[model samples]
Target: MTANPRGPNAVDRHVGSRIRLRRQLLNLSQEKLGEELGVTFQQVQKYERGTNRVGAGRLWNLARVLDVPVSFFYDGVNEGAGQPGFSEGDQTPIVDDFIQSADGVALAQAFARIKDSKVRRRILELVRTLAAEEAEATATEAAS
Candidate 1:
């Protein structure tokens, strides 16, 4: 079946998000990925934004270039109710959105380079604390 007329469907968006996330994690620019795929960077942007649907062969090529299994693109998809999309309660999209951002990618890469498990745990705790404090401040402001 074809996607919705309005735009790419949920599955397409999810797959595109995965592609973008993997590309960023590997520190590859859209231009670089496009070169590897023999496509222009604008084409890569369309794929990343789900403005264009990826063909099966293209998906296979992307998997190979990204050094991941083909199934990676469908990793967090929900197959419930005979529909292919993310569930309302699924956190994958939220996490993917964060990890797709510039700051998120930088933070993730820096964190990954830390070899000490205890240090990693401590960093996680610190981030959690900071987030909680920020949330509290936001709530206080909202109450004002």
Candidate 2:
């Protein structure tokens, strides 16, 4: 079956998100990725936004450029329940969404480069403390 002309299918959106995720993980800009795929950066944007469906051959090319198997795009996609990349039992989507952002990707990359294990632990503790404080503040605001 074909998807609607105006909007992408769920599978297409899932694949696009996966593409964006992998591209960010590799620190590749949309233009660079588009160059590798022989497409314009605008086209890449469309693909990443799920405004366009990737064909089989194009997906194969993308897999090669991204250094991931084609199946990577479909890893979390659910075909049965009419939802793509969302499973009833899965709980980490919010985290995934955050990590998919440029700032989040940069943070992860910088954190990964830290050589000192102790420093990494300290940083983790600091972030946890900050998160706890923010949660408490939010709760207080909600109650007041």
Candidate 3:
């Protein structure tokens, strides 16, 4: 396939996002990850943004440093017939973006620690309600 003139292709972007997610999950900074990989932090940023394509060897090193298999980078990628990006039905990109954030990670960690299923369900309902209310308020304000 021809290189995308606009930038890295979908697969690269997906891989970069996964790299970022794994790094964040381990509470590792881009600088720290870069140090481990013997690259500059800016290079790490490029990798995470998909501005740079990672080679096979580099990807293997990343997997080792991140404590995940190389396949983890392609976990959410869709390989439908000729399609080379995320599947239409997948909400992984959005969810991944959220989970990569500090608040999202914090909330997820805290929620996961709750052993009571009922309490967890209640918390989920509460969050859903709050989100619904916020959406409604935003819609109302937009219509005004």
Top candidate on lDDT is 1
lDDT per residue for candidate 2 within 16-127, as digits (tens), equals 8899999999889999999999999999999998889899999999999999999998887664523454443554377667777899888988999999999999999999
Candidates 1 and 2 compared: the better one by lDDT is 1
Global CA lDDT computed for model 1 = 0.86
The digit string of per-residue lDDT tens for model 3 on 27-112 reads 89999999999999999999988889999999999999999999999887766512555334454557776886778887888999
Model 2 Cα shift for residue 79 (angstroms): 5.6
Among residues 3 or more apart in sequence or in different chains, the pairs in candidate 3 whose N, CA or C atoms overlap within 3 Å are: none
Query: TM-scores of all models?
Result: 0.82, 0.79, 0.84
What lDDT tens digits, residue by residue, belong to model 1 across residues 45-142?
Answer: 99998888899999999999999999999897766512545343554556666787889989988999999999999999999999999999999999
Query: Candidate 3: global Cα-lDDT?
Result: 0.85
lDDT of 2: 0.85
lDDT agreement with native, every candidate: 0.86, 0.85, 0.85
Highest-TM-score candidate:
3
In candidate 1, where is summed lDDT lowest over 10 consecutive residues? 81-90
CA lDDT of 22 in candidate 3?
A: 87
Q: How close is candidate 2 to the true structure, as a TM-score?
A: 0.79
